[model samples]
Every structure is written in structure tokens, then in C-alpha cells.
Target: MEPIRAAIVGTGNIARIHADSLRGLGDGVRLVGAVDVDVDRLSAFCDRYDVPARHPDLTSLLEKEQPDLVHICTPPGTHHDLALACLEAGSNVLVEKPPALSLAEFDNLIEAERKHGAALATVFQHRFGTGAIRLRAMLDSGVLGRPLLAICHTTWFRNQAYFDVEWRGRWDTEGGGPTMGHGIHQMDLLCAILGDWTEVSAVARQQARRMDTEDLSMAHVSFAGGAAASVVNSMLSIREESYLRFDFERATVELTHLYGYGDDDWRITPAPEFADEVMGAWHSGASGVRSAHRAQFAEVLRSLRTGTPAPVTSTESRRTMQLVAGVYASAFTRSAVRPDELSTDSPFYRKMEGNGPRW
Candidate 1:
């Protein structure tokens, strides 16, 4: 099979992950070009990665390089426009998490994808880990019975300097606090495994930062399966720990990636009562972050090759964005917000609203 040519946008922190994944794709993929408005950053990225061409903007990149895929590594707020542009250019797109600022923007991207007949997907590579895949499979197969409750405890250390970037803390730029920005992976995993949430009540704070948005957030979500969940996400902390624990009717499953991004580091434990059920479905040993990213990239390439379906479709991404908007609205109103209950009048439903709540 011919290599899938890829152009990347944004030369920031996470762009390295995309570049590394492309390099690891061997002949399955090639890094065709990179685009960024910041010429200095764009030049630095191309030189560092030895990419052939660096375009001043997406329009030029799409016209000149004409990559088969556009990997959007830009911030959440830029996803809708960039994705639409890529789809219009007849290139498939793989955008980073929190697909867009709101469910509406996400819907716009979805429409654009459909109109262009392009494959548009959200990047939630964390869900591709061995541990996560096993857990999802077990749950899907009813080996663990029905999940009763879930706890996603994700805490990390990011000081003020981390938000010192020009657009880090603003809702217009980066979206919400940890819940929308940092903990989105866990949220994605939660939705992937447990299904859509019915409603949510949340509280948010900016206790440790000078940013315009909250640095901490807590939400209680009720899933459609009658399984309740509590999510605690924050960047204000000393020791960092990222964990996902699910309690099922037959057994309890837990996986933790607190140490950072890697598969061998996860721990999966099942309840003693359901030992047989869990053991029968046991599967572990993931390659690592690079491998997971590569796995998703390969899936995207396959979708483009066969004109089939991408693993994480635009509709799925819109659901994720809806959940994100629900979290932000829950925190904003100090009330419960339903997953499908966004009003046209809701501020979160409105596009380009100002920065989220402040401390």
C-alpha cells in the first residue's frame, strides 16, 4: 500500500506526538508538510523533524502539499474551522480531543465532513491502550455484568507558568479548565466504555492560578445505564495521579495511568468474587504512547484507503463535545446539566462566548 501523506498543523507540545507517530509509521505514512501562523515555531518544527515544506498557513499547505490527511494539533477552539478547511480540501482529518468549542461547532464540522465526503475523526489515542481495550471489551461483552458506578480521578501538576502561554487559560482559546482541557481523555474513555451520560452537576475553581478560567473542576455524572460517576479533574496538585475505576454488578475493574503516558505502567484489578469472569477476559501489555498513537493513525489511514468508516467519527466527536459543553454549563450555573439538553440560549451553546468562569 502507498504511504498516506500527512500535513500537520500547530507546532506546539502535542504536535511532537503526532510527528513521532508519523515517523514510526514506516512506509504506511509520511510527513508531507507542516502549517502554522507562527513562522518561527513552524520553521523550528520543520528543521527539528526534517519535514520537506513549511507553509505559512493551512490554505497554502492544502493547496501546495495536498496531503492525504491533515493532523490538527491546534487548540480546541481552532478545530472547527481547520477541520472544515481540510475537509473542503478533500483531505481526511484527525483532530485532537474536545473536538470543538461547543456541540454546535462540532456539528458544523460534521456537516462539512459529510459535504466533502471526508473522514473526520477525534483523537483519543488513550482509548487504544491494551488495558483500556480489555476493559471496554469486558464491559461490552457483559463479562463484568453491568457497571454500577465509575470513578475517574485524574489530577496533575501544572503551575502558573504552564498557563503563561498567550492562549492557555482563556475559554475563547483553550476552552474550559481541567475538565474540558486536561481530563478530556478520561471523559472520552468514560463515554467510550460506559456510554452517554444523562445529566451532570459540577463545581469548578481557580484556586491556584491567575488564569481567566478555573484550574480545578468536579462533576457528578449519571450514565444511561444507571451507573453513576464522579469526575475530579485539576492541575493544582503536588503528586500526580490518573486513574479510572469501574464498579460492576459482577466485578470491579480498575486501571491507573497516573505515572504518565504508557501502557506497561497501567494496573488492572478485578474483584475477587468475579475472578473467573475477569480472568477469562484478561488482556494487557500495551506498547506505549507512541504505539497507541500509531495505532489510531493506521486506523485513520485504513479508513481513507477503503473509504470505509473512521474509528472515531465526527458524530462521535460531537457527542464528546456535547459532554464537554455540559460540564462547562454545569460548572457555570451551579446546577445539573443534561447531556442533550443544551438550549439555544445557553451561553455555552453560543459560539465564541467570552472566557469561562474566573476564581
Candidate 2:
């Protein structure tokens, strides 16, 4: 098969992940071109990656190299426009998380994807990790039985200096703090595991960070499958951890890691009556893969090759992003918000801040 012609849009830290992941895929993918507004950074990135061409913006890169896929690693605020442009040009796009600034923006991109012949996918790498894959399989197979309760916590510290990067923490740019920028990874995985959510009642606080957005958010989410999850997204913790716990009728599963997790990070405890079978299944579950950009990029390639939509399709991601926006909407409105309430007429659908944050 011919290598996939790929391009990176940003030269910042996350873009490095995209570039490296693309390189790791070997002959199946090619780093055809790259783009960045900053000339020096772009040149340095292209030079380091040995990219064939570099352009000032997406338009130039699209017009020249005509990459088969464009990875938008730019700021959350810029994702919609860049992704829209790529899709409009008949190029598939795999954009970084928070795929858009708001549900409105996300929906627009969805429309563009349907209108154009190209595809659009969101980056929710945690869902692709082998551990998550195995767990989902078990749940689907009824080995774990029905999910009862779960906890999804992404507690990591980012000092004030980290937010000084101009686009780091703001309602308009970063899109609403830890819940959007940092914890969305774990949260997306949570949604992927539990399926659709029914309602959300959340509270957000500015906490320790001095920014235009909250540094912490807490919420209770009820899922359609009769499961409830307690979620917390915070950047104020000193001893940071990304933790998730799921309790099933037969067993309890837990994963603990700061960012990406491997098989060793997962633990399962089975109810006495079902202990033998559950442990045997857990022991035989898939292993030897860590959750990261490369793990997901491989899946993206497979889907493209098979002529199917990529993993974490926009519809799947919209639910996760709905939970994010729900957190903001519920916190600001001081009421429980349902997924249906985030419709066209809803303020939260129009903007994540939803008529600005409560504070």
C-alpha cells in the first residue's frame, strides 16, 4: 500500500507527538509536509523531521503537498477553522481534542465533513490503549457484568507559569480550563467505556490558577446504561494522577497513571463467586501496548485503509465534548443539564462558556 501523505500544522509540543507518531508508523505513512505561523519553529520542526515541504499556513500546505491527512495540533480555538479548511479541500482531518471551541462549532465541522468527501476524526488516544480496548471487550462480552459505578479523575498540576503562554487558560482560547484542555483525555476514555451520558450536574471553580477560566471542575454524570460516574478535572493538585475506577457486578477494574497507561497500570478484583473466571479473562486480555498518539495513529491508518470512518469519530467525540460543555453549563446555571438540552437553542451549544462562566 502507498504511504499516507500526512502533514502537521503546529510546531509546539503536541505537534512533536504527531510528527514522532507519524515517523514511528514506518513505510505505511509519510511526513509529506508541515505548517506553522512561526517561521523559525516551522523550519526547525521540518528540518528535524526532514519534511519535504513547509508552508506558512494550512492553505499553502494544502495547495502544495496535497496531503491525504492533516493533523491539527494548533490551539483549541483554531481547530474548527483549520479542520474545516482541510475537510473542505477534500482532505481527511484528525484534529486534536476539544475538536472545536463549542458544540456549535463542532456541529458545523460535522456538517462540513458530510458535505465534503473527506473524513474528520478527533484525537482521544486513551480510548485506543490496549487496556481500554480489553476492558471494553470484557464489558461487551458480559464478563464484567453490568457497570454500576465509576470514577474518572484527571488531577494534574500546571503552575501559573504554564498558563502564561497567552493561549493557555481562557474562555475563548483554551475553552474552559482543565476539563477542556487537560482532563478531556481521561474523560473521553470514560465516555467511551460507559457509552452515552444522560445528564450532568457539575461545579467549577477558579481555584488556585489566576486565569480567565476555572482550574478545577467536579461533576456527577449519569449514563444511559444505568451507571453513574463521579468526575473531577483539576490542575491544582501537587501529587498528580490520572485515575479511573469501574465497579461491575462481577469485578472491579481500576487504572492509575499520570498520562498514558500501560497494562501494568490496570488492576481487577473479582467478586468471590466469579473470581476464577474474571481473573482468567483478565490474565488473557490484550497487553503490551501503552496509550499514546502512536497507538491511535495506527488505528486511524487501518480505518482509512479499510474505507471506514476513523476511530473516535466526530459523533463519538461530540458526546464527550457534550459532557465537557455540560460541566460548564451545569456549573454556570446551577442545575443539572441533559444531553438533549444542549441543542441548537441552548447557550452552551453556541459557546462553551454559555453566556460567560458563572464566576
Candidate 3:
């Protein structure tokens, strides 16, 4: 089989991880070219990965190399335009998380995907881990019964120096702060397990960081499956942890880890009557895989080969993004926000800070 020709745009930190993940795929994919405005960073990244061609920008890269897939590893503000361009150029796209700055921009990218007939996927790698997969499988099999409650918290520390980077914490650039940036991963995984979220009431505060976006956001979400989740995203914690807990009728499953998870990071406690069956299912299901870019890339490559929609499709990503928009909307407007409330006409749909944040 001919390898999928791949290219990386924006040769920065996350781009390096994307290149490494693609390289790890071996014969399934090939790194054909790379592009970045910074010549020094681009050159260094190309040399490290042994990438053969380096282009000055996305236009020239698309016109010249014509790669089969393009990875958008740029900042949050740049994702919508880059992904749209890649789709228009007849290439599949794997974009990093918080796919776009707002629901409007994300919808535009979805439209481009339909008009151009290319797959558009977001890099929500947390969903690809075996622990997540096993939990999902068990839930689907009815062993866990109905989900009741969940707690998704991403409390990590980022000193003032961390936001010193130009695009670190701004509404126009990085979108919102921890809620949109750091917590979206756990929130996405939360949505993955609980299914559709129906309503959300949230509050965002600048707190410590002196940026336009909030340093912390706390929300209460109601899912369509009758599950309620309390989500907290903060960049002010001295001790960091990414924790998620789900309470179901039969069992309670919890994942505690900073960045990624192994089997040991997950714990399951079942109700007395269903303990044996729940434990058996959890033990025998998916195992050994850690949540990382490589696991997701493997599935993306397989979907490409099979000509099916890729994982974390724009449709799937919209749910998570909607929850994000809901948070900001509820926070800014001082009321509970429903999924239907975030229409194209809504301010939150256009920008994460609806009608400008109060604080």
C-alpha cells in the first residue's frame, strides 16, 4: 500500500510531537514536508525529524508538496484558517485540541470539509487510551448501568512566566485560559463517557494570571443521559492533577493522572451485587495502551485507509466545543446556557467571551 504523504505546519513544541507520532507510524505514513514562518525553528525541526522538504508557508507547501494529510499544530487562533485551507487543498486534517476559537469558526471548518470532501479530525488523544476505551466499552455493554454523576477537574500550575509567551493567554489568540486550553481535554473525555451534555452553568475568573482570559473556570453540566458533572479548570494550583470520576448505578470508576494514564491510574469500585461481573469486564477489556498522540494517529491512519470518518470528527468535536462555549456563555451572561442557546446569532458562538466578560 502506498504510504500516506503527510506534512506538518508550524514547527513548534506540539508540532514536534505530531511529527514524532507520524514517524512512529512507520510505513503507514510518510513525512513529506514541513512549514513554519520561523526559519530557524523550522530548520531545526526538519533536521531533527529528517524531513526532506521545508516550505515557507502553508500556501507554498500545499501547492508544491500536495501532501495527503496536514497536521495543524499552530496556535488556537490559527487552527480554523489552516484547517480550512488544508481541506480546500484536498487533504485530510488532524488539528490539535480546542479545534477552533469559537463555534462559528468551527462550523466554517465543518462546511469546508463538506465542500472539499476531506476528513477533518481534532487531536483529542485522551479518548484513545486503553483505560478510556475499556471504560467506554463496559459502559456500552450495560455492565456499569446508567451513569449518574461525574467530576472532571484539570488543576495545573502555570507560573506568570509561562504566560510570557506572546500568545499564551488571550481571547483573540489562545482563546480562553484554562477552561478552553487546559481543561478541554478532560472535558472532552468527560463528554466521551457521559454522552451529550444538555445544559451548563459556569463562572470564569481571572484570579492570578494577568491576561484577558480567565485563569480559572468552574461549571456544572447536565448531560442528556441524565448524568451531572462538576468541572473545574484552573491554572493556579501549586499541585497539579487531572482527575475524572464517574458514578454509575453498578460501579464507580475514577482516573487520576497528570498528563497520561496507564492501567494503574484507573480504579473501579462496584456495588456489592455487581462487583464480580464489573471487575471481570474491566480487567479483560482493553489493556496496556497509554493515552498519547501515537494511539490516536494509529486509529486516524486506519480510518483513512478504510475511507471512513476519522475519530474526533468535526461533529464529535462540536459537542466538546459546545460545552466550552456553554461555559463561557453561562459565565458571562450569568445564567445557565443550553446547547440550543449557542446558535450562530449568539455572541458566544462568535467568540468565547460572550458580549465581553464581566471581569
lDDT of 2 by residue, 18-100 (tens): 98998898999999998899999999998999998989988999999898999999999999999999999999999998899
Runs in model 1 deviating more than 4 A are 259-263, 283-291, 351-359
| Whole-model lDDT per candidate | 0.79, 0.92, 0.94
Comparison by lDDT, 2 against 3, better one = 3
- All models, RMSD in angstroms: 2.5, 0.8, 0.8
Please write out the lDDT profile of model 1 over residues 1-359, one tens digit for every residue.
Answer: 78889989999988998898888768778898998899999999999889999998899999999998899999877988999999999998898877787766777788888898888898887676666766777777878888889998779989888899887887778776687788888788788889878998987887889887778888899999999999988898788888888888877667666634555555556678877667767653233443267778777878778878887887666666777778777777778998656766667786423234533
- TM-score for each model: 0.92, 0.99, 0.99
Regions more than 4 Å wrong, model 2: none
> Whole-model lDDT, candidate 3?
0.94
Worst 10 residues of 1 by lDDT: 282-291
Winner by lDDT between candidate 3 and candidate 1: 3
Question: For candidate 1, what is the TM-score?
Answer: 0.92
lDDT by residue for model 3 (15-117), tens:
9889888888898899999999999999999999999999999999999999988999998889999999999999999999889999999999999999999
Task: Score candidate 3 by TM-score against the native.
Answer: 0.99
Question: Once model 3 is optimally superposed onto the true structure by TM-score, how far is the C-alpha of residue 46 displaced, in angstroms?
Answer: 1.0
